[model samples]
Target: MRRLSTLFAFTLIVLGSCSPSVKILGSWTSPSMSTTGYEDIFVTALTENILARQTVEQDLDNLLNEKGVNAQSSFNILPPGFKTSGVDKNEVLQKIKALGSDAILTVAVLDQTNETRYVPGTTMYSPMGYGYYGRFWGYYSYYNPVMYDPGYYTTDKNYYLEANLYDAETEELVWSSQSETTNPASIETFSKTFSETIVSQLIKDGLIIKE
Candidate 1:
């Protein structure tokens, strides 16, 4: 019974430690936009992985379209493996502008880190039980302290991603957010969740309306 209890406790601790988290480290919204929600948006994902980039941008474009926003994916405008070469950036910008997109949304991976550290286990002492004469000798009562083994160290991996919204007309950044995820399960899941979060935050900041 004691062994079973210990195993259960350890399982709970391990499960509790395996949590994925995401947060907006910082953001900036343009002062020019008086209302929420952009009427038209051009979505782009800058990732070395072509498939992942296309998936993310398409997901974002779909989400924005669901919110009644006109969104165009850069994948549709730019050919496969599109990179600055013979084509001028100004020309690409002009093409996007011609699509009637006032804002351009860019999502990219900023950094990733993996490290190992010593995670010391905690030592707890059991309380003394009271007997009939315990109260009388309370001040002088003594008990042996029980110590547990120190916890083993574990390695962890983290990923950081950034999303930015630029005003196409003014060529200025309208809003941006940075997010960190610990041990992301998969690229597809992370991209979808991150895209939803970014759009929701943009709405909350009144950068775009739900209309």
Candidate 2:
């Protein structure tokens, strides 16, 4: 019984330790922004890497669609050679409008940094640490706090990203956010969590409604 209990406790600790840290650092929604979220939204990723950009946009599209939000990926709509900047702004706007997109959702990885950290090991003790098995077994049962082997070094990556919602008709920014992602398990996980976070904020700001 004690062995099972110890194993269960250790499992919980390991799961908690491996959880990723993701957060929205700041966000702003224009007061004049439409309260009713766009029914047809176009998603885009500004990452220079073609595959990464497509993956991110597709992830966002899938998540938003799951929530009953109408979303399309710019990667699919635009040509392979399309560039975000140094292009004809009017032509880009025309293309987005032609798709019946009322709003544009853009995501970009602004910066990234790596950090090394060392965590010192420590020992712990409990009051009811050990007890002799009562009459029958004549054995001992011990309850000990888990101890770390030694201090260890780890390298962590921090991804700084920004997202924005634009009013396609007026060509104005409606909402924007800055977020930080630390040590995401996978790109898929990061994209899902990031998209969900932004959508939740939009709901909170009365920009989007939960279906």
Candidate 3:
């Protein structure tokens, strides 16, 4: 009996170490971005759009890593451009049935924006003769140097992503998390920093991670 007790205690410790504090598994759908009023600007800044998606995916991976979760065992990210609208619960279930995962995470991007500066200016030049005369007279030209003007431009937008965790077999949403943010520049440097910021917030707010 004493030997059995020791073995059981050891098994418990091993299980505790191996198990993810939060058991989320199955296929995860990438968040969808909303196409809204800033269509024109969004098209113009295509790079930012791509970066935003990449950042979100990376952030999710990072979160799983931090939690000591085996990424492959816990989740599989769905391919890009996979539409969730008409996909029924059964369909999701069928696809993940083989995995026998614990849950499914669905992410959606509600809104996003990218902004850049548009500075306008022109160079000033004097006629050759005028400059020659000024130089000859040891006097500067009366013409004023052109000044460049930079205007503050922003593409203010809101983004929403809904994460739905479903049972692997039943495919029912058991847990969900939605996130929103404004003016996320989408530049690599800023996007990564902001992505981490937002993910941390989500984990905090959802009580997914201990503070």
Candidate 4:
């Protein structure tokens, strides 16, 4: 009984040490932002990598729409050269207004950094078999030696990202957030998970309603 409890406690410690895929570092909301929440929203992601940008915008747009938030991806409306060639800002805003979007959400990757961390090794005990663990004397005789795991150093990549929400009508900033994602597996995975994280937070902040 005591051994089982110790094992269970160790399991909890390992689980608690795990890190989330996406973590919000900080957030802010404008005092003048609407209290009723936004309905039609435009989503965009800023990145030199066109594929990454498109994936993020599309994933986030789909997530919001699934929640009945009426979201649109900027990639669908913006020209192919809009990002690469740097189109006129005035013209882009004019086009967005025609889409009937009441709010705009833009995500930008500010920086990517490599972080080195040392994971300390832990000791584990393995029983011979279930039958062997039946009696205390049997278990004591069959008790495995303390297996010491060697510690190792690993490098993780962290992407610093920022999100900004703007009221379309007034063209003023509303909600802003900064977050970090550690060691994203792939562009698709990052987009999907990060989109979920952002939507969940926006709902919590009362900036958007799931509806």
Find the 10 residues in a row with the least total lDDT in model 4.
1-10
Total backbone collisions for each predicted model: 6, 0, 6, 0
Worst 10 residues of 3 by lDDT: 37-46
- In candidate 2, how many Å is residue 134 off? 29
| lDDT of every predicted structure (CA atoms) | 0.72, 0.71, 0.38, 0.76
Query: Residue by residue across 1-211, what tens digits does model 2's lDDT show?
Result: 0122322322222233234566999999898898677777888876445555666788878877877778888865675566558888888888888988889998876666668999887766544423445533333223334344677999776666778999999989999998877777655566667778888877777666668
How far off is residue 36 in model 2, in Å?
2.3
Arrange candidates, best lDDT first: 4, 1, 2, 3
What TM-score does model 1 achieve against the real structure? Answer: 0.71
For model 1, the superposed segments whose C-alpha errors exceed 4 Å read 1-19, 34-36, 117-150
Task: Supply candidate 3's per-residue lDDT for 83.
Answer: 48
Q: Across residues 19-111, which tens digit of lDDT does each residue of candidate 4 receive? A: 438989989989998999999899977544566667778889899999889888887676445553566777778778889899999887666
TM-score of each: 0.71, 0.75, 0.41, 0.75
lDDT by residue (79-153, candidate 1, tens digit) is 766768898888899999999999988876666566788988887776666562556555335333556778897
Model 1: number of backbone collisions: 6
Residue 104, model 3, lDDT: 46
Clash list (residue pairs), candidate 1: 36-208, 36-209, 37-207, 37-208, 37-209, 121-151
Query: In model 4, which runs have C-alpha deviations exceeding 4 angstroms?
Result: 1-20, 83-88, 122-148
What global local distance difference test value does model 4 have? Answer: 0.76
Indicate the TM-score of model 4: 0.75
TM-score-wise, the better of 2 and 3 is 2
